[model samples]
Target: MAKELLINGEVITVNANDEIVEAVAIENGKITAVGTTKEILQLQDEETRVTDLAERTLMPGIIESHIHTTMYGANVLAVSCKDPEIRTLAALLQKLKQHASTIPAGQWVRAWGFNETSIEEGRFPTREELDLVTDQHPVMVIRACGHLSAVNSEGLAIGGITRNTQNPEGGEIGRRADGEPDGRLIETAHMELYQLAAHTRDEMREAHRVASAHFAEKGITSIHDATGYGLQNIEALREDAMSGVIAQRVYAMVGALNKPEEVVRHYMQLDICTGEGDEHFKYGPVKMFLDGSSSGPTVWTTAPYTSDSGNYGIHYLAQEELDALFIPAHEKGWQVTAHAQGDAAIDQLLNTIEKALQLHPREDARHRIEHAGLVREDQLQRMKALGVIPTPNPTFFSEYGDGYVTNYGDRAQRMYPLASYYRNGIPATITADCPVADFNPMRGIHSAMTRKAPSGQVIGEDEQIRLLQAIRGYTLHAANASFSEKETGSIEVGKFADLVILDRSILSAEVDEILGIKTDRTIIGGETVYLRSKEPVNV
Candidate 1:
């Protein structure tokens, strides 16, 4: 492969000092040099391909620390029920019926991105309502959080869920006054029914292709897939990466579901540990959910939700059960990243992790708490001391902030304290739990910097961070969360040439205009994978 040079641009290195250079040289898929245009141009040979940025802004390619690639891809094909698309219960049914018309009868139809709070009804669609859309086809529509879902009568029948069927431990099945299934399935119940509607290998492959292309277009050169759906999902992702269908690097967190022992067996059987695989695909951590989602009012919180006076939310695992899973996984050399949203759940996670550390004593394990949504100051101190990284979804502030206010009231002020994390020297990485929120780093950045909700309300002004800090959370800090900081996080010599060219400087853009900035080009491994159609400015 010939060397490449990107010159005459604002190169925001995002390095230790956050250097701004004019040009960068790449060779053999790695950055070879970064300096002034004249200095970098001197290294170019006759075989070199030079891209004059025309004074465009260049930065390290964005990294999404938390996302479900396969699910995101599948959602691309699912019926759209998100706000602004299906704002009312009537609109939702109409959209579902319209989508069901495109498929044959008796076939399953999956839809996603519906938030009850954003709808006119302010509640999940019931089975009878979904039946109005499709009685012949089994229909399942996922909540925006991906933790809750509603299924039609056909879907219930397919899952063998009856009026007498007991809800799985750590999950709930909604019921009507007549004691019949109401179509609302929470946590485990949601996953159980979803499995019945699983996509085929070919469909999954195509989903991956669509997802990878979408990431490239958005300037995301890397992602940490929060849920690697067991060995099959990992193998599929590897195949996608090897076949060049997935252009970005992927770090997969093993999704063992409720069976942590299964994860241990699989790891031992395959002789695969954390950090296994090449740069393009690698094993990250063993992911487990400690509680449900805040959006569903099921997150295990210390206090009862304002919306539900008596309910303190669901706690998925007992202390002993959590210890049983964590200690064994930690001793087996697997890094753990638990999805703990509420303070109570976070407490359980931190306690289990602390115990695991004491029993195993592995320094720099980099155990992560995904979406520490309601972390306290003391928890932050403990997390910092234990070297635990908190990867929070800042995008939630914009997408679900209004709901947060309704759910937690004044407590919402403490949600996702981005500024507090930095002030206390906690290495926080911001993310968008895509499919929960759109996988747009700019929106996450904007939310972090402004703490502004879609309703034009600021939920927590004290938690707002600077633009630079927000950008770092998406780039360098995100890489650090996955232990890939030394590889591709920043623009530096000897790092992989993962870079993005933006139409404007995110640093200097007007606050309201930040999210409007466009990605001019996305380059990975010294190759241009995505380029805008607009003509580049000539130098």
Candidate 2:
């Protein structure tokens, strides 16, 4: 057995009892003991490595529930367009222009993280504006929501898009007053644009490495890679993880969104479904997308947005189409999940899942609704009764809360109802959505309590949860989402030693101070994968 002991920490166990212990003992990368320093000291032998915590805080390594490993990696290496970075349309265009100037004439100039709400002009950049950046090279600037994008003339031509090019089944192409293509691609169209401007294998590998290290530095030990482009990308990611390019435990999702229909069909022939593989990498749910983004005002809403009258937003698939995809996956015993942001989309999801369950029910199969951004009182109750899990992104409160208030008015309070999830007996998991918003687990925890925008406006005061509940959402609850709770979620005697040592005590800190709390060290399986301090961690 390995020898390691940590003591004198505010150890928040996030267990059934929610205990705060003083120390923990580790053996063979699993928790061996937990209690006061003296109790843990008794378990330590002469060869054991015991380290003083010096009154720091220790908790489960933050589990980022839903993140796009490869996508976030590529976005990190792209131009900056996210709010508080490139705020004005002119400034964004200028940044793209500067980036274009450095690249070769025929190369693609890509940018990500655009927020129309946060920018000075409060609008999407036109294709013409992007052309001004550079017409010689194809340019695609994707919105932060990842639901829409605007590409230059060259890009449209490269994709064979024209005024007459019809909108795909689940996507749209922007057009000007005269019916000329305007360069904007929405939903599935953006997916096509991504395909046209796909990153190189070398580029993706390099970016994946950067993203892995970044997640480690942020104290994240586990993540769900929700959107791998196709089987090829999935294979590549698995290889990366197996080779230690990705250190964190990965719950890699399979076909539905980026995966071609044929690829999914072929996969069904395999003996495996979900929950396949080992501790390092595992197959997750059959994931799919059902609607546009709430912040993009393209969410499939039952009520028209307050900001856009007579427009109820977009639903990517019909009930029949969703059933064809989901019912098969559910029947096959794979956990099913979809990106349903608005009430209308969630409604569609509930209907289909209910039908699938009626056909063949698995009591323990926790089908999930990702980004249930907006849900009514009735929907929440239905979710609890049907045993559907709602995985919401609390960090969106910091990035899109003001826009939600502006677009939905009082109805915005229904978005990401964390407190209501608990009251209704649902263990709603929380996510940061990474490239869509801030990825820090601390920011997600803070958003759960405040429900505030960067402007300090609390959009949903009634939905705010307590600090401990928020902590649970990111730790044990997150692990439960992937069926890995028994192995890694808490500080139990047999759980993996996936723990984060923080510079300050989040349990004792004021609500606002939580965001500033940095991770001093991140340990996974008794190994220090990341350490902020340079000093020796000796016995």
Candidate 3:
């Protein structure tokens, strides 16, 4: 068989020995050998292709342990409310008016990331206020929390929601002083409008394509796409992978939260999942959400929020209700990654997982807790004991830093404790949680290492992790969380040849310099798929 040799580069093989090799040999899209140039050349036949990358440092392609790729992708093309200049209802209204002109008439105009805390008015935009921007079409703007949606009267009417619409079991409709629906949907209630406007499979595949290219640019070769959005989203990704359009590997989690029967059906069809999808795709885990995001005011907090004394946050399911979903998923041999942010929610999740573990006893299950943002110390120990990986979005430090400090007060110091996880021997991985935060790994690593928020204050200095720890969180630890460490997380011999060559050394660079570390070359399956040099190298 013909062989390929990539020689003369610093290969940081994060294998057992942490081998640093000068060259590697590849055959049939997998590494055949990793050693000195001479050793790799010896194994090559006359038909072998040898390519020297000169001074580049070759390491494992990074893995984003947690993200919502489809949502992120759609957001790439959606109406964005992330503008920094808009700080008041007036400004937001003007921006929406301008945005409406850009879109075709009558199509619903949707926006995301609108936060009351950031706005001068300090409240969700009223449906009446939004109607002024566009009466000809329905307009819906989501709170930055993803747990709430502010809709114009037109939008409310289109969704069949009325003043008498009772709150759904897992969701709420904000009501006026007179008991009329306020056009603000909370928690699961927002799903009614969202589901109606959800993208088709073709749109999702396109979103994945756009998202993959963006990830590749940031040196992210793999991501634990938090949930599949829907079964069609999963199917769309698979179809894209088969057609060779997916440029980054996806560790997909089935996004089945409503239909328990569908969850079981998808679990039973696990045989159809290709855990290994070339270099661009893969599948693992089945996602469930016990609660909503902290920013959303629905995260099942232990205490009432300072602003909302009447509310202790919302729970999508009770303890027993959650266990019914968790136990069966774990028993079916699927890794479970839940969206649990509040301490109360985390405690409930740990209790249920403990029971499931007692029943099944899979010590190395590597079940993950997504957005374990505010875990208690006791919860930390239990997570460590159960090998629950906490896939956190460290980038939250930069985006929602102020809100966290304002919400938790001094206790904000422990919001996303990377150091605590290290001390407890729990594997912690960081990601973008995109559509919520940007999907740049550099930004996340910098946040992990420095604990500095965009507001120029260090929110949790004591909880800051080391640079090496941050790197491993994105690479090795992330792979372990997704159960893909053996093949692709590290640059190891006899493994899939997934390599990321960076423009700068992230390990020895200054904290600020980390953000400038760009991707120079991306190799998947021993083939150079992405290169940005002015001149092409001869192979």
Candidate 4:
């Protein structure tokens, strides 16, 4: 392949020294040189392709450390009940009703991104309310947190759930005063119904295409798919990756939900443990959810919620159960990344991981605590000692910071302590768990640098970090989380040419203006996959 030269731009090489260069040269999909434009041009030959960046800010393509690619792709087709779209209960019903009309009667109608706090009703829409939208169609709307779902009466019937049906051990079914199902399903129950409302393989393929295009347009060249449901989801992802439908490099975490042992066994039989695939697609870790979402008020906490004095949230797994699953996987060399939001859940996760390490110690295992939303000083120290990375969504602070204050009071100050992570020398990765929040990394960067919530309140000003640190959290630190640092994180020599060009310099922009920065072009492996129409340039 001909060498490609990107010049006349600010190349923010997020390397070890955080150097800034004016140009970079790529050969065979890897960076061959980085320096001043004149220096880089010296290496160019007649066969080289030269592209002027118009002084745009060039950097490594943003890496979303935690996301659900397939699900996010599918959600693009689902009815969006997100904020500013449906902020009232009546609006939600109207939106659902409108969506139901677009689909055939008796078919399932799925929607996502519903936040109770944003609605005037200040609660999840009930079955009766959803039934008003469409009794003929089976309707289900998932909360922004992905841990809760509210379904219509038809949806409940389709799932074979009834008043007589008992709640699953790790889940709950909301009930009405008359002992009938009220349409709200939490945690495992929500997941089970979600499985029942499955999409066809063809549908998933289209979803993958849509999602890949969306990510590429947003300048995301890589993502860590936080959850892969089963072999089927994994197969679809692989097929998409191999077929080039998914342009972003994917590191999937095998979800160990429902039948944990069975899932582990299936992966083991296939001999696909961590670090099993190429850069385009790879298996990274075994993921399990130990608690629900803090925003949903279902996260397992030692203290009761401030709003509800008696409710301490839910714990999805027992210690023995966690041990039974994690130990075997750890023994087989699968790094674990468990979702633990509340402090209590964090404690449980830490204990389980400590035991697994003691039984069969693996140095630099890099077991991760996904969304360590709330942690005490002690837990931070323990995380540092265990070499466990805490991957938290800073976007949550900007998008749902008010909700955190409402749910946890002053305790919300401790949520996603980026500054503390830096102080403790804990390598952390900032992510936007898409569908839960917008996938734009700039929003996360802004939130971390300012700690300013959507309500214009600074939840924890002291916890804010520098803009450079936040950027690293999304680039170098994020790649390290997936064990891909050696291959593609920064704009380093010999690294994959996964790079993005921004319209503005985020480094010098005002904190508030950071979110306004736009992607002018996104290139992966020296291939220009997405470029602004007006700034058309050859790949």
lDDT of 1 at 184: 91
User: Which candidate number would show the highest lDDT if scored against the true structure?
Assistant: 4
Mind giving the per-residue lDDT tens digits that candidate 2 earns over 308-373?
788888876789988998899889988888889989999999998899999997888888898898
Per-model RMSD to reference: 1.8, 1.7, 3.1, 1.7
Give the TM-scores of the predictions, in the order they appear.
Answer: 0.96, 0.96, 0.89, 0.96
Collision pairs in model 1: none
Give lDDT tens digits, candidate 4, residues 208-252: 899999898888999888764566787788888878999999888
Off by over 4 Å in 4: 256-261
TM-score of model 2 (CA atoms): 0.96
- Alpha-carbon runs more than 4 Å astray in model 3: 1-10, 17-27, 35-56, 84-106, 256-283, 306-311, 537-539
In order, what lDDT does every prediction score? 0.85, 0.85, 0.76, 0.86
lDDT winner between 2 and 3, please give it.
2
| Model 1: how far residue 258 lies from native, Å | 6.5
Which residue runs of candidate 2 sit more than 4 Å off their true CA positions? 83-85, 101-105, 256-263
